[model samples]
Target: MSAPEGPTFRELAVQALSSVQHGYDLLAPKFDHTGYRTPASVLDSVTGALRGLGPFGSGLDVCCGTGAGMGVLRQVCRERITGVDFSAGMLAEGRARTPVAPDAPRTDWVRADVRALPFGPVFDLAVSFGAFGHFLPRELPGLFAQVHSVLRPGGTFAFPIGAPARPGSRHYWELLAFDTAMRVRNALWRPRFVMYYRTFRLAEVREELLRAGFEVELRALEELGRRADGSPRCRLVVATRPV
Candidate 1:
């Protein structure tokens, strides 16, 4: 979960004791050292898929943590790119790390909560990476509605979703244990940290997206490879607002 430069156990423990926003603020400096940052391989795969779908005008990265998904937006979007998040520390780190050339597409960082995004139906494309677990199941309707509200007609909101771990598998047990631990911790602690591993299922997500006025489509991320049953290990969910 971490490299040599990542946070120590003590540091992580302290962060875990804080609210989700404050915890991320505490972790912002060393966030990239940990496994929480989305991998470049996943970003590249999404970029390739989106390149075919795009030449998009302006793009937004929803819940952009330290601007990893901004790389994907840069590759595919044409005019301007914006990243919005609730954490000031994370946004500051992103501004410091994300480079800009004189001729590069315009870049902007806005600090706002994703549940109530502050934007018009302006973006042609929007992408999020590995940040959905923070929201509970009941929040899906409002969350999807917020995303849908920010996309122009014919715009897309895209993200990757991994296949569930097979029952009885080691990975399955690991996730189950992690989620149970989180549940217990939230129950016992104040200022609950809302990160769980098992809540976002594809079928339920599709229903919510449709309810939010998106026409949903699922495409296999073939670059991520297939599982034992020949299903894709990861799939890209492309939800488009109607024109």
Candidate 2:
């Protein structure tokens, strides 16, 4: 609920006023301490969901912030793993914290935009976490296309999507408030930040993935339990490029 331990409101305001890359760079040192970092539970669930599909040769963590998703890739990818982020600050922290294993898959940190990936069809698997909110809905097609381009035929791109907030729940209002604030900030600021909590809906996401030439499937992460309606609390959207 509270902002990360360090960085007061004024400091965060200053950071937010900057470009997204610069803001994250400034926040990198304390980024993991904040609740903004994807939780371990979500990461674990994604890892489990990808296990049966894998024994994959290479993996990429797109928009990898501080490399949490890279940790998951390390387990499933046998040969090499790459973490790419436009934020050098975040990538630096990721490079430092990521553990190295003897004879394990090699890891590389690259700086690139997801909408315009720099790699060819080289990766067997690609995953992203907690980074989609940074992209506008209009950007989804190109973003997914770029990821699709970098994967070999039959390769997969995976990421988790949580259920929408219930109408009357506190989380609903909290998200609404955050989005409203972001809109206000963008209106008043230059080089606006693109994070909008509600923009990435499941249906629209699936449509975009399909348009990008991926055959998409949703696998409910049962380990996260279910909502009152019996629907999964979260699902891993696995989109595979046709071979």
Displacement of residue 137 (Cα, Å) in model 1 is 0.6
lDDT of candidate 2 vs native? 0.92
Candidate 1 residue pairs in clash (backbone atoms < 3 Å): none
Deviation (Å) of 86 in candidate 1? 0.7
- Which candidate has the highest TM-score of all? 1
- Residue 179 lDDT (model 1): 95
Q: What is the TM-score of each predicted model, taking all chains together?
A: 0.99, 0.97
- The TM-score obtained by model 2 is 0.97
Where does candidate 2 stray beyond 4 Å?
2-6
User: What is the TM-score (0 to 1) of candidate 1?
Assistant: 0.99
Model 1 superposed RMSD (Cα): 0.7
- Candidate that would win on lDDT: 1
Pull out the clashing pairs in model 2.
none
Write the residue-wise lDDT of candidate 2 on 1-243 in tens digits. Answer: 335476677767878899899999998987887778888999998898899898899999999999999999999999999999999999999999988679779999999887889999999999999999999999899999999999999999999999999988999999999999999999998889778899999999999999999999999999999998999999999999999
**Over the full model, what C-alpha lDDT does candidate 1 score relative to the true structure?**
0.95
